[model samples]
Target chain A: MTASVTSLVNQPYKYGFVTDIESDTIPAGLSEDVIRLISAKKNEPDFMLEFRLKAYRQWLKMDEPTWAEVGYAKIDYQKIVYYSAPKQQKKLNSLDEVDPTLLETFEKLGIPLSEQKRLSNVAVDAIFDSVSVATTFREQLFEVGVIFCSISEAMREYPELIQKYLGSVVPVGDNFFAALNAAVFTDGSFVYIPKGVACPMELSTYFRINNGDSGQFERTLIVAEEGSSVSYLEGCTAPMFDTNQLHAAVVELVALDHADIKYSTVQNWYAGDANGKGGIYNFVTKRGLCQGVNSKISWTQVETGSAITWKYPSCVLVGDNSVGEFYSVALTNNMQQADTGTKMVHVGKNTRSTIISKGISAGKSENSYRGLVKIGPKADGARNYSQCDSMLIGDTAGANTFPYIQVQNNTARVEHEASTSKIGEDQLFFFRQRGISAEDAISMMISGFCKDVFSQLPMEFAVEADRLLALKLEGSVG
Target chain B: MISENSPIILSVNNLTANVNGTQILKGMNLEIKAGEIHAIMGPNGSGKSTFSKVLAGHPAYDVTGGEVQFLGQNLLELEPEDRARSGVFLAFQYPLEIPGVSNLDFLRVAYNSRQKHQGLEELDAFDFDELVQQKLDIVKMDAAFLNRSVNEGFSGGEKKRNEILQMALLEPKLGILDETDSGLDIDALKIVADGVNQLSNPDNATLMITHYQRLLNYVVPDYVHVMANGRIIRSGTKDLALELEARGYDWVLDEAAAGVA
Candidate 1:
């Protein structure tokens, strides 16, 4: 890890270089050997390796997706480094002996971490780059029969639970990205909120991309048993560099009878230079399953940074009377290209889903809204409603909407509405004559457009999302 | 510089404008002098609103010919913002709502923009608030409106009142009310007219563009120019507005085309 971070300061990024770390890298290609090597290095049992090898072979047969509303050169699989771990850093038994740099990094990212004098019962696992650095409050959580750790750690510690629920929601051959992630995924989060237990506090992941070229492939599995509920927040950022970095992560969520899960993300990856030279190509797949009766799942995201982003955090309403929701505000500035929305699939009776998406495109950026709502034959009395709107700041920018609805049941009802508009100069003059500058005028217009989605976030996060939109669109007024 | 007969604070000569190759205003000419309020009355497509938009430097309309002289300099030469800074306020027929920018913040920017252009010190938030509070009373606008987004979700009457409130804050040399009385009710119209009445003076002129004489009945105009086919065909006093109101527009259309020929 030290040499990779150091040598990165000098080497040209596009020209891939293999830095010396205790990396469990195979011959820089995806095949049966690579998957087996990866599973073996993690000390996984033979069954897991077979699953990975199957996923790897399936990924090879599948073509890299070209359907995303973004542009990039073809990815060379032989060039990507699959795995790396920290050298000689001991996994501490107590909080006092944890690596201070890891703690300091989380603190700089503004993780509120202090032992509450009385109620410090929340457990936290700080995952930095490709490794899980520290897991806090484990002893207390264990006393309550709770299990929370990294996915690799979960395989070693609680194999039975992992075996039962691992591939149930999103199997090994879910999609091109998911299959690739299943084969090469390094480290992510594993959380199991036990039956009838409500998590005392929010579980958070502050993800950062430090090493260049090496993509961070994280897989998060969140399971809420019957009558359980949990809320999780994921925040991502990266060090500023002048090359396009890649981050492909997959997240799966499951909620059983009467369980509820709320997931929110603030993705602020490095969004390239002003001339669109370098940034992060962030492609992520996040989905939740309402697995049993009366389960509820919701996704809220504020995406402000990325060179090219293709993501949809979605939900499948599989259980009877379950509810699904998606609230999002995706802002693209400069030369950024963001194509994001959500999908809600209704397969059970009396299911409900709601989606509200607001997109802002400025400069030469292109922002799109693509979503799907499907109601199966048995999903009688299913109801779905969606509202998507786009606000373009400059004339050169673009906004497009593609909503796919598949309803096979007459008893199911689905409604969708979308509109695209430019913030006319007349609006700015109207504002200027009132005493606002051009920039503030645009900022206010965008925030108002996004208020419906922003209000869904927590107070601090809502304010942060609003400010990020302003900062991302500074001077984008043509 | 404006004489009594031609209190022409704004003079346009052989003006022509087109939107996307379709001519809207062709060789139109009109003038408004200091202190006097002139009403431009015409049919829907007779360039009444286009005149206001062209004067305010809307980029979509191509100013194909002629010039607009305001005070002394060319009005078309200035950017819309600079025209605004130079005290030319156009009360749009459809006022745009800019959400998130508070009415107070917008007013301060407009206030300080003109002050800064005139080489005067800008007013801070507190002092500016005090100043705007007094002016809001003149428009009968609620003090709470200051915290809301400019013109956002405002009633039609409130939007007109807000436009006048901005005019009051900027104190422009030339104030053009482009169909300000269109959506106003009888009571709202009276309040708006009264707001305009209080702000008028010998040095600052007003040009009200209207489709009906009912608005002129309240905010009585000193001159009434009948616009026909993009040109001002006739000019007279308050009685002219009454005659046009009585005669309907068909006579003007016939007589003005004959007069032009």
Candidate 2:
């Protein structure tokens, strides 16, 4: 019985096929000239070039941080390709200008990019390798004073907005990965919701990594002006290879007075084979800033892939009466390692935040939740509530929790709760005695355990997240 | 209520079982006919609980040498779930609590599993809700329990009532109550016994394992058997229970030993 359960989760990776096409890939290495070449390739403005140079100089002096609980082989910075993009003839004016093969690739991944097959309510910005291929509903969104386009296009069209808010929330020398991403991030999504305008449709971005040895560094920035609101989501996937790939991306969000921003992510990158031979190393930095009074920002993520994951999506409350929330569900199986959670920092009076995290580990994997909740001295009556739960499938797996809380104000209130559970034989037997198959039993229990986090997702994506978790944990327990 | 020509619901022959390499059920033999209620009384460590577990095909118990026939079919060949769907239900003495799974959902799933096995149409959430509400009256359970996690934070009597509630929903052919009377107060015991008595009919059989004779006062049994050393040594009508309750099991054990000598 145990052997059969172990074999259940050993299913092969589905999105492991590479697309064959002509790609303009740079040589493997990183330096000041590489950053300059990348900036020149994108035709960036002088100020943007200066920003990249400053970040590159700072990155040269910083060392890779070893504070996370994940272990891996040393990453040789000089042996990675900093830039890779599909070769195009000229600048794209619309979706018709996209390559047919590239559109076919996205279609096979269940993300239709063409006008005839695109989703009705969602406007997607499809990013392939290191460039944005196409963005849907651009004309409709433009008519309402909403600017939704590739970051490169925004840098050219709305340069003032980019120059003002770029690197404001996360500066050039914030951390190792953020600095590296600031230096050479090729393309990502850029959204600007004008004052008092609730964007007409849902905005999304789909990222696909195709090159074998090239690193993927994308940047996304969403700014909701006063009395405006926007909900955005992102998805990621990569092909399988013998050697591990590096993915270091940065996402920053800013919400002004009476504004709201909700950001969600469904990351399904290719985890290595059963022997842990090949996969992606995902290290990302994402943060949100409630910059004006009564602003709100919420982060929800469902992470199920990557051989080693190190990420912490955080929120900084800088305005009185602002609110921040983080809801996440992370699953790891078959020798995978993850150290992921959230951080909530209260700097304004009467600020509020909530964090709920669920981690599941199976097959000899190691999963950890490391979170922090800090309250400033002047923030009177600030409140925070955090709960972290971990579930183990087999006896060989490991689960850990490290929660750090710091409160300086005398009136601040902070509460933390955590628990660990395993899928024991008795639970399965009880279900079996009730005529339920083991497969159905395990899936039902898992879906129940993740109910709280799934409820925070958007309507359509909530169903997808539930199904994805069930598929990932099939036959993984007795 | 038993007729001489009635069908046999279960027949166990020379049943020998072991748990973790230690033999528990040694050469146990028994036969239960339709419409019959049989009670087995035994001292501790006499393999009473192991008998119910073995019949339910628990993974912990290994049937070394045994032949179990249910409705003239080889019962040992089926899996635990198949045994359940084919009309064998064991109400656990200590029901396991499953967190986050509501009682209504669990009952509906189990009912649908049996329905699917019998080649019948399964009930959706709306219809299953109506059906389960009617079944709740048998055990006198409140409607609020339908939304709570299955047996999680439930009182001891509430858990036992839930077991009987499942038995009502599944409607099995042979019902085995494994010391269901251990942790119930007198009021709860009467309610549970009334539930068992109401579920009894001309087509189903009941096997109750207990340590006290108080349960028999509510749901009277036709026969009472005393089990010792992993096997039944003496059997008689309901009068045997009255005698055993008056004078403990030592006299019976001595008589069985003298007969063996």
TM-score of each model, paired residue for residue: 0.77, 0.95
Residue B52 error for model 2, in Å? 2.3
Docking class of 2: medium
iRMSD, all candidates: 3.0, 0.9
Candidate 2: deviation at residue A142, Å? 1.2
Q: How well is each residue in A1-478 modelled by candidate 2, as lDDT tens digits? A: 3664576556667789999999999998988899999999998999999999999899999999898889899999889898999998777777977999999999998899998999999999999989999999999999998889999999988899999998998898899999999999999999999999999988999999999898899999999999999999999999999889999999999999989999999999988887787889999999999998999999999999999999999999999989999999999999899999998999999999999999989888899999999999988989999999998886778899989999999999999988776675667778888888777777877888889989988888999999888888774433
Query: So what's the TM-score on candidate 2?
Result: 0.95
Candidate 1 chain A has its poorest 10 consecutive residues by lDDT at A1-10
User: Stretches of candidate 2 above 4 Å error?
Assistant: A475-478, B21-23, B225-261
The residue pairs in collision within model 2 are none
The DockQ scores of all candidates, in the order shown, are 0.31, 0.69
Q: Point to the candidate with the largest DockQ.
A: 2
Candidate 1 residue pairs in backbone clash = A272-A278, A434-B106, A434-B107, A435-B106, A435-B109, A435-B110, B7-B33, B8-B33, B9-B32, B9-B33
Question: How does model 2 fare in lDDT?
Answer: 0.90
Per-residue C-alpha lDDT of model 2 across residues B124-242, encoded as one tens digit per residue: 99999999999899999999999999998999999999999999999989999999999999999999999999899988999999998989898888889999988899988888898
Cα RMSD (angstroms) for every candidate in the order listed: 7.6, 2.3
lDDT (C-alpha, whole model) for all candidates: 0.79, 0.90
Off by over 4 Å in 1: A1-27, A94-125, A135-146, A240-243, A476-478, B1-88, B97-174, B181-195, B198-205, B210-214, B223-261
